[model samples]
Target chain A: MSCNIAIAGVTGAVGQEFLRILEERDFPFSSVKMLASARSHGKKLTFKGREYTVEEMTDKSFDGVDIALFSAGGSRSREFADAVKKAGAVMVDNSSAFRMDPDTPLVVPEVNPEAIKDHKGIIANPNCSTIIALVPIWPLHNANPVKRMVVSTYQAASGAGQAAMDELALQSKDILAGREARCEAFPYQIAFNLFCHNSDLKPNGYNEEEMKMVNETRKIFSCPDIAITCTCVRVPVMRAHSESINLEFDSPITADEVRELLSTAPGVTVLDDRENNRFPMPIDADGKDDVYVGHIRQDESIPDNRGINLWVCGDQIRKGAALNAVQIAERLV
Target chain B: MSCNIAIAGVTGAVGQEFLRILEERDFPFSSVKMLASARSHGKKLTFKGREYTVEEMTDKSFDGVDIALFSAGGSRSREFADAVKKAGAVMVDNSSAFRMDPDTPLVVPEVNPEAIKDHKGIIANPNCSTIIALVPIWPLHNANPVKRMVVSTYQAASGAGQAAMDELALQSKDILAGREARCEAFPYQIAFNLFCHNSDLKPNGYNEEEMKMVNETRKIFSCPDIAITCTCVRVPVMRAHSESINLEFDSPITADEVRELLSTAPGVTVLDDRENNRFPMPIDADGKDDVYVGHIRQDESIPDNRGINLWVCGDQIRKGAALNAVQIAERLV
Candidate 1:
C-alpha cells in the first residue's frame, strides 16, 4: 500500500529537495500533494514521472494526506501546523518554528531515529550546519559521550534558498566579467569572498545560522548541558556545507577507536589519512548522499582524549535537508 | 636621527607588505637594504620613489642595520638568525622558526608592548590567525585571564603567500573562461570553495597552523598552561583572516563587559551592534591596521560564565603579518 504524502512549502529550496529525494528513493507513495504560499499557487512540479500542481496552503492543506513534510518559514508552520495534524497527516517540519519545542522531536535519522516515533505530528529537520556536523559527530558521541563542542562552519549560498544561490551565480559572473558584483538576497556581494555575517542578525550578537547550530545541537543530542558554540560563515561554495568540529568527550577517544566507531556508523564515511594528502572537501561531497569526514584525531592541545577534531562535508540541500526528511518518512510505514 | 632598516625575504608576500607599510607609515630611515635568496639578488624594487635592489642574504646582511625584519621561510632564520643578531640588529622574524624558542620574545605590539623590553635579539611574530584571534581575545584575556580557548579560522589566500594569491586570481580567471582550474599552489581550487585541511599536517593530526595558534598565544601572553585548540580553513577571501573564538575563563563574562574591554584595547576596534546588523567583516578590515572584533556575548549554553563567544577579523597581510612586524619594529627602538 503506497502512502499518501504531502509536502508543505513545496516551492522552497529544502521542500524541493524533499520531493527530489522522495522520488529518487522510490518512496512508497500512492499520491502526492504540493502546497506552497498563495504566491506560488498554480506552480507545477514533477516527481516520479508524475506532475503535481502547487496549491495554496491553508489550514486544510493537509486534509486526507497521510504524511506532510514542511520546509516553509517558521511563521507559516506556527500558523497552520495544528491544522495539518488535525487533518490526520503526520508533519515533518524543516523550519526552526518547532525544532526546540519540548513536544517536538527534532530528528536526524542517523543520530536520533527513535525520536521520530514520538513526534506529535511533526519531526524537525536540523539546521544544515548542525546536520552536517552531527553526521561525523554523533557516532563518536555515541561511542564516547561528547561533553562539549566548538564548531565553525563554512556554509554555502544555497542554504539561503534559490535566490541566494542566484545571487552567488550572478555575482560570480559579474566579478569574472571585471564588474562590481551586485548585492541582493545577501547583505554583501557573493563573489570570491566570505563573511561570518548572515542575512539576518539576531539580538544576542549571534547570527540566526549560528544560533540554530547551538540550539538544534542540544535538541538532537538530548544533552541540554552540552557546551556548544559556533561561528557560522557563508563561503562562496555553491552547494555543500563544511564544518570543522572539535569535540570534548567525557570518555577516552583514540583515532583508531573513533575510526572504528565511524566505520560502523550509518551515515558517516571516513576520508582521513594525511600521508597521501587525502581528506574530504566540499567539492568531493557535493551531489553525494553521505557525509564525508576526515582529519580525525585527538587535539593534543586539548590535554586528553577530550578533544576530537574532525571535518565534515555534505550537500546541505540533500542530506542536511531533503534526504533526511525523506528517510524519516520511510520510517513511518 | 633615522632608523637603519634591513628586510629579509624582500621578494615574498609579507616582505612586500612590510615594504609598503614602511613607505605608507613614513618610517624614518637613514639607510634601507633589501635581502632575499640568491635567486632574487639583482631584483630592484621601487618603494616610495626610492630604488632598492635586492641583495643576497648572508651573515653580513644585518651589518650596521638597526632593525631587521625577517619573512623568509623558517629554515633561513633557523640557520642565520643568530648571526644577524650578532651583527647588532633587532631581528623581527615572521617565521615558525623562532616563535617557540625560549630566548626570543613574541610580540604583537598592541597586545604585549611591554614585552618588547625583554627581547634578547630576535622578536617572533605570531601566526596570522593567532594574531587575529588574540587581537580581540587579549583584551578580554586582560580583563580576566582566559583559562581556555577554542578557535576556528576562516583564513584568506594571501596568508599562503603571493603565489597562492596569484593562483587564486589565475584559477578564478580560468574558471570564468570555461577552463578547468589548474591548481598548482594549493591542493584544491580556492575560487569558490573552502579547504578544511592545512598544508602542515602533523603526526598528531593537528596542522602546523593550528599548533602555531596554540603555542604562539601561550608564548605571547606568557601563560604556558592556557588551553587552546584551533582548526584552520582556507577560504576564498583575498586578504583578511577571520576567527571565531570561544573563550572560557575562571570568572563571569558579560556582553557589556566584553564591549567595554574591547572598546579600550589598543589594537581592537569594536564594530558590534546587533540591532542594526553591524559587525566586522573582511571587506571592511582589509588594508586596515587594527583588528576588528564583534558579536561578543556570554555563551549561556555552557556552565557558568565559562563560555564567551566572539568574532574577529583583520588583514592577514597587515595586522597578521607585515604591519604587525612593523609595529614590533617601532617598539624595539
Candidate 2:
C-alpha cells in the first residue's frame, strides 16, 4: 500500500497542513518530494523527523511520483495537470482550476467518495465552506431529500492562504497598539472588521466563493435541480469556517431526527447541548479533522416541519482542503 | 416644544450613546436629569458641555419629567415602570421588559413610527439586531410585500454592553501577547473569534436573540403571519452589527427595483458599488445613523425572481438602542 508522493506548494498553508496530516495518519509512502516555485526553492521543511529541501516544480518533477497533491494555486494546478498525468501520477488538486472540467471528478470523501472512481488522473477538492457544510448535510439528505438551501457563511482568514492569516495577526497587533492596520492581504482591515468575500463577482450578482457552494454542492450530490443560494463573508476568526444553513426538505423532518442521524455520521461531531447552551465554535474545530455540527433546530417558519437549520464549523485548512485531498489519495492505495 | 427629560441608567454604554446622540441631533430639552443605580450615585457626567451628578433613581425620580428614557436592565425597567407612569411621564424603554407586552408599543422609528401612537404611557425599543435588520427590510416590504425572511446576524460585542467591548479589547491584547484570554463578560473568548449568540436558548432551540428577530419583525410590520427565521452569532467587532438577509416577496421583484426603492428611504444608505466590489461593512456603519445596505441581488434559490438578498450593517448603540429611544421621545413633542 506504499506510494511515492510529491507535495507541490510545500511552503504554503494547505501544503503545510498536508504534511502534518500525512504524518499523523501514518500515510504509507516509500518516497516523498517537496516541490514549490522559484521563490520557495531550497527552502527547508521537516516532516516525520526528516528534513527536506524544497525544489522548483517543473513538467518533469512528477516523473516517478505516484501521487501529486497540488495546492500552489489555480494557475499552477492548470500548468501542471497535463505533466502530472503524462508522468502517470494521480493529481489531487486543491484548487478550482479543474473542478468544473467534465473530465475531473470533484470529491468530498464523506459525501461523494464514489466519484473518485471516475477521475481522469485529476480529482478536485471542493471549496472549504462547501465541504464543511456537506459533511453533516449529506447524511440528512440521504434520509430526507433536500429541496432548497439558504446559507450564510462566516469564513476565516486562512482560506485566502498563509499570507492572509499572517495579515490578520499583524493587523490585530497594530490595531490593539493603536496603530492603523495594514491592508495588503485584504482590501479592507480584517482585524476587528469583516466584509463580503473578496472573490470576483460573477454576472449573476454572486461572488465566486458563493457560486462555488451553489455549483459544487449540485455537482457533489449529483442533484443539479436542487435550489441553492449562499452569502459568503470573511470574518475575523483565524482558521475554521462557520456556516448558518437553512434547508427545506421534500417531507417533514424534525430536529431530533437530524441530531440522531448526524450523531452516527462519519466525519461529524455533534456538539449540541441546550441546557448549558454549548455549541460548535471555530475554536473547537481549529486544527481538527471532524466537522463540528450544532444549533440543530426545526425551522419554525416552515409550517409543514419540512425545514431545518444547522450551525457548522470545520478547519478550513484540514478537512476543507489538505485532509480531503489526502483522504481521496488514501482510497487510491 | 422643549420639555424636561430624565435619563435612567445614565452610566452604561447605551446611556453614553443617548447623551451623544441627543447633543449631536440638537434635541429639544429644557432641563435634564441624570439617573443611575446606587453604584453610580454621586458620579459626575458631562452632557452638552455641562457637568451633572448622577442621582440614584427612586420612585419620585420621574416627577415633573416629560419624557423618561430607560436603558437599564430589564429587571430595573420593570421595577420603575409604574413609578415613571405614576409621575405622568412617558417612558421610552430600551430593554426587553415590555417589548412583547400588549399594552406597550414596540417601535422602530424607520419601520413603525405609527406604533408609538398606540403606546399606553410606555414605548419599547426592539432588539438591536431586529432594528438593524428591519430598517432596510421595511422599504422592500412596502414595495413588494415580503412573504418570508431568513436572517443571520454577525453581532458586535457592544450588544452585550461596555464591559463586553472592553473584554474583547483586553482579550485581543492578551492573546496577541501569548497569554490566555480571560473570559468574564462572555462565556467564550471574543478575541478574533465568534460563537452563537449567548442569549438564553428557548425550548424551540432558538436563542432569545434569534427569536427577537422573528417576533419583533412580525410586530413592527403588523403582520403576525409572516414567516421568519433567524440565526444570531457574536463576532469580535466592536460597535456595529451586520446581517445577511434573504427575503421572499408576494410576487416577482428585481434587484434594481429593490435598490431603487431603498435609495431614498429614510434612515437607509445604499452602498452597493459592484464595480469596486465594495458592499456594506461594519466599519462603514460604526458611528453612522443610517443602516448601510449593499450586496443587493436576486436569490438564485427562489423561482420567478420572488427572492432578494441583502447585506446590512448599523451601529447597534445608535439606531439599535439610544437613538431609537430618543426618536420615539421626539414624536411625543
Candidate 3:
C-alpha cells in the first residue's frame, strides 16, 4: 500500500526522532511533509539524505496526508487534530490532549494493537513513561493477572523537550566551572540534582505525570480494576527513562518464569546478569528500540511468591513517543 | 565528662565526615586520634584548628581512646573492633560486620536510642540508606504500625567512596567533552547513566545494598513483623540520596496527620509545597543533617486509606553515616 505522511511539530526532540526512525526503518511512503510552527517555518530538515523545508502547521497542512503524527504540546494537538482528521487522515497524537477521551483510543501498539481498529480517526499515544512501562507489564499481566502494580519512575530531562536536554548540558558545565546553573528550561538546577516530576499536582495529591501513568495504563490494558499507583521523579539522565516496578499477582509466579516469558516477547530484552552486576542501565536503553528489563526477582516480602519486582529502561524518544506513533501508523497500512 | 576519641579509617569518605560532624556538633572530647591504613599513615589531618597525624591502625591504637568511631570497611572493623573494646573504649562501628551481630546493638539514635544500653561493648550504626529512611519512618510507625514498606533509592556516588565521587566528576567531564568516560572507580560509566547498585548480589537475588536497607531497618526498628522490600539504584548525583517510599499501614492515616507528626519530630524537615512544586530535592538536602521529607499523600490505589507515599532526601555522608555515628557516641556520654 502506498502512504503519504505529515509530521506535525517536526523540529522538536520527539519530532526529530520521528524522522530518523522512519528513514532507518525504510518506511515506504509516496510523500512526506514536515510541519512545524511559524517560528520554525522554512527551517531545513534533512531526512533520507534529502533536505525538506519545514512548513508552518495550519488548518490545511494535512491536505492529502494519509497519516499525521502529532508531538506538539497538548493545545496544538487539540486545535489541529480535528483538522487532520477532517482532511481524511488518521492522527496518531503523542500528546495528553485526547488520551483519556473515551472516543479516542489510547494505544500502545504492543499492548493493545487491536484497540487501533476502534479508533475514530485519532489514536492517542500513551505518555512516554507509561509507554515504556506497559510494554513489559502487559505480557506479564497476561501470563498472571496482576492484582496490584506500583511504579517509581527515574525519568530523563528529554521528556520536557530538546531545550531541557540542552539545559542539562549547559547547567552541568556551568556548575563544574564554578558558575551558577542557568534555569530556563527547568525551574531549578538539573545538573547533579534530582527533583520530583515538575507537573501540576492534582487535588488527589498525585502529580499529573503520576496520574497519567495510572490513568493511561488502565485505559490501554482495559483493566480499570487493576490497582496501580506511580511515583514519578526526574533524574539527571539525558534521554532514556528507568523504572523500578513492583507487581502483585492474583496467583503465585517466579522470576525465572518471568525471564523465560519476556525472552520471547516482542520489543523486550532481558539483561539480568546478577553475578556480573550488569543490569539494564539507561545508557543501554538509549537509542535502542527495545525496552530493556532486568533485576527481575521474586518480592520476598509476599508469601507464596505472589509478587515480583523488576527494573526496566527504555529510550523515551524511541519506544516511548515518536516510534510508538510510527508503529501505530505502520499498522494502518 | 571529658573523653579521648579515636577515629578509625580517618582517610576515607565517611571517616572524614566523622571529624567534621564532631567539630560542628562540638562533641565533647579532650583529645582525638586519627587512625588509618598503613598507606595513609602519617598523613596530616586538621581537626578544629589542631593538626594531628594519622596513625597506622594496629592492635594497640585504641589504648588511650575512650570512644572509637569506626567508618572503615567491614573487614577492618572486624579486625579491630575487639581490640577497641579490649582497650576499654566503647566502639561505634559504622560497618555491616557488626550491625547484625546479636551481641552488638544496632542503633539509629533517632529511632532506637534505648538500644544503646544493650550494647555488649560495640554499638553498630545502621546502613546509610537505612539510617536516612528510618528517621522519619519511626515516628509514623510509633503512631500506627506499618504493615509493609516498599523502598526504592536514588543513591549517590559517595555511597561507594571518595574515589567513586571523583570518578563521577571525571566521567561527566569526559563524556561532555566528546570522550569516552573513564571507568576506574566503577565497573560502568556513571556519567549521564544509572544502574543497579554495584554491591554483590545475594543468592536470594537481592543486592547487598538492598539487603542492608531491609535487615538494618528490621534491627533498628525492632519490628521484625513488618514486611520490607527495597530496590537500590545508583544515580549520577554526588552526595545526597533520595528515596520514593510506599508504606502500608494497619489503619488509615491522612497526609495532614503525617505532616503534623513530622513537623514536631526531631531531625526531620517537611518540604511538601504542592502549589509551587517545591518538594524535597537532593541539592536541598546536601550538607544538611536533617532528613528532608515531603510528597506525603494517600495511595489511592488501595481501597481504603491504608497506604501513604513519601519522597525523602538526605545527605548520605552527614545524617546517613558520620553524623549518625556521632549521635550514637553522644548518647554514650
Candidate 4:
C-alpha cells in the first residue's frame, strides 16, 4: 500500500529540505499534504513537478494520512501532536517536545530502528548536533561499547533556523562592507566571531543544543549508563555542523579497527587521510545525506588502547534534520 | 640601561601585529629596527609615527639588539635566530621551530613567565589555539590542578598566516559573487566551512596545532601527568580562535570557585553571563590584550564533580603571539 504522507511546518529550511529530499530519495507516497503556519496557508510549493497547496496545520490535517512528519517548534507540537495522533496517523516528530518523554520512542533508524515499534503513535527525531555526533558514535559504541563521551561541536548557524542563516549572510556582508553588523537572531556579532549561547540556557550551564546531544544519544543508543558531556558553539559555516568527539570505551580499540567499523556503518563515511589533508569538511558535506568522519585516532590521553578521537561533519539540514526524518518515513512501511 | 628591539619577518601578520601592540602597550623600546627576507627588504614600515626601512635579515642585523622578536616561518628562524642570539639579543620567537626543543624556553607569560630566564637566546610562544585554551585552563589548573584535557577548537584563518586571512576575505567575496572560490591558501573553500586538518600531521594522529597544545601546556604547567587530546580545526573566523575545553581536575571544583580563581588570573577576564547572553566572543576579544573566558560549568560526565567545561576566545595575533612574546621579553629583565 502506498503511504499517504503529511509534512507539518513545511516552510522552514529543514522543512524545504525535507520536501526536496523526500522527492529526491523517491519515498513511496500515494499523496502528500503540506502544512505550515496560518500565514503560509494556500501558498503553493512544487515537488517533483507537482504543485501542492500548504494548509494551516489543524486538528483535522492528519486525517487519512498514514505517516505525519512534524518539524514545527516544540510549542506547536505540544499543542497539536496529540490531535495528530488521534487522527489515526503515526507521527515522526522533529521537535524536543516528546523526545525525553518516557512514553515516546526516539529513533535513529540506523542506530535504533526497533525503537519505532514501541512508539505510542509518535516517534521523535534527535537534535541536529546530536545526530551528527551519533552517526560516528553509534558505530564506535557498537564495536567497543562506549562508557562515556565528551563531544565539543563547532555547529553552523543554520541550526538556529532559517533566519539565523539569513542573519549570518547579512552580517557577513555587513562586516565585509565596513558596516556595523546589527544582530537580531543572535546575541553577538556573528561575522568573525561565535557565541556558545543558543535559545535555551539552563541553570545547569548546558545550552539546549548540548543537553539534547547528551540526552538524545542515551535514548537513541538505549544505553542509560553511558556518560556524555558536550559544549556546542555556532561557527561561521552556513550549512554543516562538525563535532570533535572523545570516547572512552569499555575495551581497547585501534583507530584502524574503528575506521573499518565505520566503513560499513550506515549513514557514516570515513574521510581520514591526514597526510593529504583529506577530512570531513562542511564545504564538501553541504547537501549530502551521509555523515562524514575523519581525524580518527586512538585517544592518547586515555589508555590509547581504550580511547578514541574522531571528527565528524554533516549538513545539519540533511542528516541532522530532513534526511533522518525521511529515513524514518521510509522505514514506516 | 635601555633596550634596542629588532623585529624579524617585519611584513607578516604576527610581525605587523607585534609592531602595533608594542607601540600601543608602550613596550619600553629605546630603538626599533625592522628585518625581513630579501623579498620584503626595502619595504617601508611605520612604527609609533616613525617610518623604518626594512632590511634583509642577515647575520649582522642583530648586532646591538637587546631583544629581537621573530615571527618568520620555521626555516628563517632556524637560520637567523641563532645569529640573532650570537649578536647578544634575547630572542622572543613566535615560530614552531624552537617550541619543542628541550633547550628552548617556550613561554606564555601568564602560565610560564619564569621559563624566560632559562632561554638560551630564543624564547618560544605557544601555538594560538594552545594559548587560548591555556588562558582559561591555567587559572583553574592553578586553583584545582587539571589532570587531563579534551579540546576541540574553532580557530580563525589568521592562524595559518596573513595570506590565509586575505584568502578567506577574497574567497568569501568570490563565493558570494557566484564565482568559484580561490583556494591557494587552503585545500578547500574557507568562506563558509571548516576543515579539521591543520599543517603537519604526526604519526600519533594529532595535527601540529594539537600537538603543540599537548606539549606546551606540560612545559608551561610543569605537569607531565596532565594529558590532552585535541582536534584543531581551521574555521572561517577572521581574527580570533575559540576553544571548547573539557578539563578534568584532581579535586572537585565548583563553577563558583572557578569564577573567583579566574577573575583575578594574570591574563584572563571573566565574561560569564548566561542570563543576558553576555560571554566571550571573538569579535569582542579582537584587539584585546587578555584572553576572554566564559560559559564555565561543571561537567556532568565525570564522577566526583572533577570535570569543568569552559569556552575561551583570544586574538591569536595578540595574546596568542605578539603580546605573549612581549610579556616574555619583559620577564627577561
lDDT: worst 10-residue window of model 1 chain A: A196-205
Residue runs of model 3 more than 4 Å from their true location after superposition: none
Q: Quote the positional error of residue B54 for candidate 3 in Å.
A: 1.3
Index of the highest-lDDT prediction: 2
Task: Name every residue pair that clashes in candidate 3.
Answer: none
| Model 2 per-residue lDDT tens digits across residues A1-333 | 899999999899999999999999999999899999999999998999999999999999999999999999999999999999999999999999989888899999999898998988999999999999999999999999999999999999999998999999999889888999999989999999999999999887889999999999999999999999999999999999999999999999999999999999999999999999899999999989999999999999988999999999999999999999999999987
Per-residue lDDT tens digits for candidate 1, residues A167-217, read 886787777678898887998766777777564777676788888888888
> Which lDDT values do the candidates have, in the order given?
0.84, 0.94, 0.92, 0.86
lDDT of 4 by residue, B92-187 (tens): 888888888989987877777777778788888888888888877887887878888998888888888889999998887777777989889887
Give the per-prediction TM-score of chain B: 0.95, 0.99, 0.99, 0.97
Clashing pairs in model 4, backbone N/Cα/C closer than 3 A: none
Better of 2 and 4 by TM-score: 2
Best by DockQ: 2
Interface RMSD of 2: 0.6
CA lDDT of B293 in candidate 2? 96
Every model's DockQ: 0.55, 0.87, 0.83, 0.81
Instruction: Write down the worst ten-residue block by lDDT for model 3 chain B.
Output: B217-226
What 10-residue stretch in candidate 2 chain A is worst by lDDT? A98-107
| Local lDDT at A64 for model 2 | 93
Clashing pairs in 1: none
Q: What is the C-alpha local distance difference test score of candidate 3? A: 0.92
